[model samples]
Target: MADNRFEVPEYFKCPLSLEIMDDPVFLCTGSGHSFERNWLQKALDRNPFQDPITNIRYGDRLTFGPNRSLKAAIEDWKQKTNYHSASAQRPPSPPHRIPEPPRRPFGPFTPSLFPQPQFTPPPVLFAPSFFPPREPVAPPRRPRRHFIPCSPNRLPEHLLSRWEWLR
Candidate 1:
């Protein structure tokens, strides 16, 4: 036996009409509270039904939903508000990898197309002298430290000598 009772989900129930809707209208709003565009304009110009709140007639706004009035429409839209916001705030998925385009064949009239080189593992070489006996030498000793004393007054004399050389 087919279950025929209209046991719709709580979210499916239109907030405005409190009834099951068919082609529900979703409002893309800002701040998750206010509608972004002129709801009246989008409802009138883009919609097919008249504004329920304003009592204005619009052709494009009328969608194939169950709700009739604008208040009813807004009600249906409100139910999906949380869903729309969560989906919008979620990070976008990474792009899918597209298949590479087919390569054109090289003909006699065209220049010989060279195939891309493949990775080739080099042959490992071996030698009996690889592990040769080592004759180690001792490290050289450090040289004695040498310190030269200088005065601040000598700096100007050094600069003067360089200036005289320039002349």
Candidate 2:
């Protein structure tokens, strides 16, 4: 694995968003095109028989299906990144190396890559628990009864922690 962080596999990217695919779907149009479900649906509504990127016409009959394997891979990637982000105590492992799944010459689509001996659920932190049970919330800035208009407050661009300044 490379020393660089935020590295994502090429196949994991969504054609429409140009970002890592959140929910992959097989448009099954020309070349059996794949995209994020919402993105494809939006594009399909506009042009049912044509691919957005290639402009290749797939004819009138359009079909779409979920890319379960790709979706699972994406979710797994998300979990790993999130876990790495939250666990400051745990030393960062080497960058994740996702095993490549099978793919066509032009179309890169496959099912299982991280084939576990058996299915295993993600960790507890991947659940709704963001902060620890004992971690106290920061004090609210505004009074409950007061309404301040045009509060020129902006949220931190990245995770805000006391440790950020140390780096």
lDDT of each: 0.48, 0.70
Q: TM-score for all predictions? A: 0.21, 0.43
TM-score of 1: 0.21
Instruction: Quote the positional error of residue 101 for candidate 2 in Å.
Output: 60
In terms of lDDT, model 1 sits at 0.48
**Superposed model 2: Cα runs more than 4 Å off:** 1-3, 30-32, 83-167
CA lDDT for candidate 2? 0.70
Could you give me the TM-score of model 2 versus the true structure?
0.43
What candidate 1 gets wrong by more than 4 Å, as runs, is: 1-40, 47-49, 52-84, 106-167
Per-residue lDDT over 1-167 for candidate 1, one digit per residue giving the tens place of the 0 to 100 score: 75333244555544445554444444322111212123434544644465444455644544332223544644555564432433456899989999997687766666545665879988758666887878897899999996443644445666656556434
lDDT of 2 by residue, 1-167 (tens): 66444577778777887666777988765465568788888888998887787788875757789999888987888687752423455787999899997674542465455554877887676655765688778988985695333422332435335335534
Which candidate comes out best when scored by lDDT? 2
Every candidate's CA RMSD: 22.4, 32.1
Distance from true location, Cα of 38 in model 2, Å: 1.1
Candidate 2 pairs with clashing backbones: none
